[model samples]
Target chain A: MTERLTLALDAMGGDHAPAMVVRGAEIARTRYPQVDFIFFGRESEISPLLDRMKKLKAVSRIVHTDEAVSSDDRPSVALRNRRSSSMRMALDSVKEGAAKATISAGNTGALMAMAKFVLKTLPGVDRPAIASFFPTLRGETVMLDLGANVQCDARNLVQFTVMGNAFARSVLGIKEPTYGLLNVGSEELKGHEILHEARQELSGLNLPGRFHGFVEGDDITKGTVDVVVTDGFTGNVALKTAEGTAKLYTEFLRGTFRSSLLASIGYLLARPAMRKLLKRVDPRRYNGAVFLGLNGITVKSHGGTDALGFAHAIGVAVDLARNGCLETMGRDFKAVDRSTPDEPAQAAAV
Target chain B: MTERLTLALDAMGGDHAPAMVVRGAEIARTRYPQVDFIFFGRESEISPLLDRMKKLKAVSRIVHTDEAVSSDDRPSVALRNRRSSSMRMALDSVKEGAAKATISAGNTGALMAMAKFVLKTLPGVDRPAIASFFPTLRGETVMLDLGANVQCDARNLVQFTVMGNAFARSVLGIKEPTYGLLNVGSEELKGHEILHEARQELSGLNLPGRFHGFVEGDDITKGTVDVVVTDGFTGNVALKTAEGTAKLYTEFLRGTFRSSLLASIGYLLARPAMRKLLKRVDPRRYNGAVFLGLNGITVKSHGGTDALGFAHAIGVAVDLARNGCLETMGRDFKAVDRSTPDEPAQAAAV
Candidate 1:
């Protein structure tokens, strides 16, 4: 366990926290013996699950964090006031060098605030961007700013492009990933002022082989572009909308199948294919978003997500921490890969 | 045959110019013979369709335009180049008072450009905004700037607010439509400067109703908020993403339904309900986007859409023209109702 990449799970984060969080960590420990883990939250709330996991040969330690951060509380205030909150303590482990990364299935704002405060921003990084692996109809696309800095400046967007590109290459096995700035139109005058300037910066970046031009929302599911960059606000909306619509549509099919006998039979026979399709679009498997620009690695899962989903996030944190992704991004930002298309479009504007 | 609303159709404007446009119009015409129409496009291309419609007891007229607008052309250039494009001629009718409102299934950019040129902007309005109606899970919600103006100033957002409130009232039948600015987060400081100012203005709009602070992207379907507002650039992306995802998800359902013999039987029994559900989410049915802020009525339909979809757009145009929506919005902007909760918030801003 000493040589393994250690993770601290925030047991009291997310809609189904402590219970699902403990279960997910337990599964990860048993599945990946090389991974070390610590569960942080109220002892009474976590002990039962810890006992069960220990019985299942999952982990060796669990720390009690009696305080909790409410989803509605202002992130900065919650982090500063709730000293023993699970989210804060998990983040503290990363700061104290006990854990290489932390996983939180709690309030995104609170997690981001705590991570930035405890772990601090990686050097030469303006902001820590959020990037996720999305299962698109056209294979998969690595997307950034899924809910980090929503109102992004030209510099913020540029940083997202750089970090996202590194993620696509290192984690997604993408080769010479194409970069796209999400805009309403593909024209030079298609987006807001920041987008306009981002285009100019990206053009001047002189990366090894960056893709040209803009992409729209449809492109995310279409795979016409590789690395999609957007402000966190729009990106969050796009992701959530996509998820909600997919769910509604799935319900429509279920109703159709249940309406009659023949349709029921057809649904049963086609069940495998339907399941495959569902698996393909499932966020759980693709459930990883590295909070880039953080000195220590951090990954945040959806608030209401289940165990399998949290495990997927852990997989991402493990890969990132193991590969020294933060260092790579730092190098990428510091002008190490000038010839690589993954570098910033312009020199850091700081 | 004379009872239904007579619509002016831009038959030569879309990607399937003249042909599919003619057939779609025929479908609409046949479905409602009382619905008369004016088809504008090349005489040669439209003549045969007119003859067929006449055989089907569907009355229709044709106006010949010598040119067409392509997808790639610039919006402004498309309008200037197509001096006699069918889309333009249809608008001419609306202007000359020949038609109540013009309906175009053409290059949306071209249709929007030509529409603004021929119809002109309303007083106190700098540009006409685009709006899309969604049969939301909660109710009908109007999402605007669904791709009209790319970049907007804080002032433009205010104008859009006034107009969207009007559109929601006119089309959705909501006495006081709730206004929400699209952003990453709901907090006042979550967006760009203009949006930040927009929040203050929105909070202070006093537009005869309530201003629901700010709403994020996923709120569009959650029924949490009513009227979603943004610049055309972002609005357009959001609209298309919703439409595209809707289509893809529905297709996934169809694939499930057709999977087996038993499912086929179930499909038969569910046919009625399935159609009802499809109708609930049909993008074509929710096709028209009113060009708000325009002095005269103009409606834009998806360029690749069918005639029935265009028919719906025609209906929207009729509704706006009849209701004098712009003037209604003007009044609301000038005065928020005393009983409305948002009145105080909008008082100083308006």
Candidate 2:
């Protein structure tokens, strides 16, 4: 039998907190029988919830922590004042090698700051990027630098590509995933100088995945590439815009069905098919946002997600740890020849 | 009767040029009988189409031009070599006061470069922005810097707010539109220093629209503000991403209906409601992307759009010109105190 994989959880992080966290762990336990969890939060709040989850309690250990990071805490403030916060303690477990991965649904900025401090960045990596999976026509595609490094240079973008490529392979199980740089237009001269420079550098490298050159924004949902690489600023905006649009589209659909009694009856007949469609595009299926380029595996769950969504985040951490994502990234980075990289540094500085 | 508004058209622009352009003009003539057109292209090709459209022929005059801007031409290359091109000639008509506005469905970069060179920017306006109307839950919202100025500072963004506010007032007929700066998060300390400074400056101004402070990406579709202001790069990415997401969502819906025979029958029963829904989200309804801050009004039609879409673009230009959008913007700019503007210039430079 394979050895059990341990994952650290910040039980007090998300909106629904101890209840959702405990229930999500229970659900995740059923899926990943060989995985154990180390919960960091107030035991008093978590113990009663754990009592309700017998299967999760069987393989769980709780570390009492009264202090927890508030959603409003700034990254700097959290780092200085909330050293013993649940989010920090969870990251600490990963740093101490007690857990293979850590999952948190805390204040994003504060979590990123703490994760960077506790786990540090991989060698030769300037900053860690937040990577997440997006549902596409061709199944799923991964995008990186969602909101991590806002103003990235060519070097930072290239690094993102490498990290994204590695994550797609390790987590998604893609044999040889293709990646593209997201830009305004597909033309070479369309975007700023930094994008052009990054494209040049990426094209010259004998990377693992095939670099599909430049891709426009529409290509993200078209599944034009396995991985879409962009700076944190644009990536974040695109992601949030897509989410808002999706919500708006669904609302419009609901309003259309409720417009008439006949349409409502028609909706009833299509309910089963609609359920399948909803499941296919469910946000919970794409909950976890992995912090790529970090020394240890770190996955950030959406703060407003429910138990099912939190469970999916746990699954993402488990998959990454089991697939040895960090080791794969290390190997990929070392394979790249950094002999003529002065251009990227100069471009990034701008 | 009101004076006729003449709009210059680059008949040779777009993929299905001359055909789509002439046909679109014919369609637009039916919508706005008071508008006349000065078509710039090969008279030999357009005369026949015009002959088929008697009403359009009555109000239109063809100005023959042998040259035209190619879709593949670089902006700088087109500006230098394509001086007598149809696109250039069309803009010339607006510059010479022959037409109140000009509309093109050619290369966006080339059109912007030529338009800027022909019509100087408004007073206190550093650059012109591409503004478009997006369908939202709260009807329609205007967004600027869609793909114009790639890198914008606090000052450029503030200027965008003024232009967008004017566009919403004059074109959209909103008495007091609410505007916001798009950012990664709604928190005051979320984005870069430029955003913070822009927010500070915007809050201090007694602008026409209510400044909604900071808004996240989702706020655009939620219609949290009447005018969504962002830099070109982020705005462009967000726009395309939303488009892609809409397409994906529609495809998912179609797939759902086809998944089962019962679902297909239900779709048939709800066909009328579905048609109404389709009409609401149709891209043709929002075809024109206005170039704001230019001395002369200019609208860019989607290059790949059909006659209906092209007609809508002409309608946008006509509305902007008839409503005196330029005058509104000029008045608003004059109202702002420019004495303490060193902060904006410094922020914009970075």
Of the candidates shown, which would achieve the greatest lDDT relative to the real structure?
Answer: 2
**Runs in model 2 with CA error above 4 Å?**
A186-189, A337-350, B186-189, B337-350
**Given candidate 2, what's the lDDT at residue A289?**
96
Error of 1 at B48 (Å): 2.6
Q: Which candidate is the best by DockQ?
A: 2
Worst 10 residues of 1 chain A by lDDT: A336-345
Candidate 1: residue B308 Cα off by (Å): 4.1
Candidate 1 per-residue C-alpha lDDT over A289-337 given as tens digits, one digit per residue, 9 for 90 to 100:
6788788888988777899888888888888877767776777777734
Predicted structure 2, TM vs. truth: 0.95
List the TM-score for candidate 1's chain B. Answer: 0.85
lDDT of 2 by residue, B217-317 (tens): 89999999999999998888888898899889989999999999989988887778888887777788889999999999999999998899999999999
Q: Candidate 2, what DockQ? A: 0.58
Superposed model 1: Cα runs more than 4 Å off: A1-3, A56-58, A82-84, A186-189, A204-212, A258-288, A335-350, B1-6, B55-58, B78-81, B186-189, B203-210, B247-282, B318-350
Deviation of model 2 at A2, angstroms: 4.0
Going through the candidates in order, state the TM-score of chain A alone for each one: 0.90, 0.95
For all candidates, state DockQ relative to the true structure: 0.37, 0.58
